[model samples]
Target: MLEIKNLHASVLDIDDSEILKGIDLKVGKGEVHAIMGPNGSGKSTLANVLMGRFDYVVTEGDVLIDGNSILKLRPDQRAHLGMFLAFQYPAEIPGVRPWQFLKAALDSKADANGEDKMSVRNFSKLFDEKIEAVGINPNLVKRSLNEGFSGGEKKRNEMLQLEVLQPSLAILDETDSGLDVDALRIVAEGVNSMRSPERSFVVVTHYQRLLNYITPDVVHILVKGKIVKTGGPELALEVEKDGYKQYMAEAEVNA
Candidate 1:
């Protein structure tokens, strides 16, 4: 459902150096792919570039959803096309209530797709259902988005967004970071419940703990901006045991 073809990207207007050397990946419909890598491996950069974040420029290659390029699309435009990215560090938007933020997101997506607008009454009902399913406190929705929320709470908020939006493809960039065991399980359960034939997930994580709950169909070892290895869930276990040291050294030597 998603494919990255020799993607080469660099920090926008900052350097001519490429963070992504040549990333080639293909994720099938309903498949979950986990990208495991060390810090500075450009794992999050791939996620941001896929979302069309303006600060990172794609120097070469293309990111496509169902065979169409999304390189030039705005982030919101990508969202409208059922693409979602759960950031590693979620921003705290003061004064924006979760209810207002989510409702507006739904409305904007609907309008962009020329679909019927959702009424507040309907949205509230749907939101409440998702809140219960995702185990988010209903009271949390009344507060500003992620403002003063604990780390787990922020991850839960992101899962809630995923549940409500039901994107075709979800790219989670280290959502397990900073989460305790309980919070991690909660987040994993939330993701597990959403798995379906119509959905795909690209989970980028530094550890294999999250994969214990949500087993991916494929695991990729990303090093120095390139995907050096791809395997099944066993690959993650190997990573957990042996770590990314070998991958790092090999990637550097090849560079």
Candidate 2:
């Protein structure tokens, strides 16, 4: 349902700062793909570019969702198109509670799609259900969004949003970072529960720990801003055993 064609991007205000180089990927509906790479391999850059982050300029390439280009759309516009990016470092909104933030987001998406917003009572019911399913404390969500929340709490909150937003394609950028064993399990469960025949996920992670819980149909090795190897789940195991040294050596040689 998502396609990236020769995707090249560079950071704004930096000379010769291109990060992603010629990234081409195709994720069909119901599929799960994992991107694993060393630091500065442009994993997060790809995520931000796909979501239309303004700080990064797409020097070349086109991103298509269901065959239509979204290069000109803003981040929110892409959200309305069923694209969701769970940040590696989720931002804390100091004054807004999760309930308020999510309600307004749902309303906005509903309005955009010419659908009626859910009533407060129904919304509350669903919200409570989701928060529980995602293993988030209801009391914590009542507080300002992500403010004073622990790392695991922030990741759970992201999953709660995913559950409520129900995006067609969810790009989770290092969702497992800073999470402990329990927290990782909770987050993985949240993602696992959301998997379905009509939805897809692009999980970008550095290690194979998260992959143990959520097995991906495909695994890609990204190095030096390019995807150099693509394989099945076995590739992740190989990376875990041998590390990315070989991949990095290959990438450098190719470069």
Tens-digit lDDT track of model 2 for 23-111 = 99999999999999998899989988999998999989899999999999999999999999999999999999999999999999999
Question: What's the C-alpha lDDT at position 219 in model 1?
Answer: 98
Give the per-residue lDDT digits (tens) of candidate 1, residues 145-240: 999999999999999999999999999999999999999999999899999999999999999999999999999999989999999999999999
Kindly report which residue stretches of model 2 are placed more than 4 angstroms away from their true locations once superposed. none
> Best candidate per lDDT, number?
2
Candidate 1 CA-lDDT value: 0.94
- How far out, in Å, is residue 198 in model 1? 0.4
After TM-score superposition, what is the CA distance of residue 9 in candidate 2 from its true location, in Å? 0.1
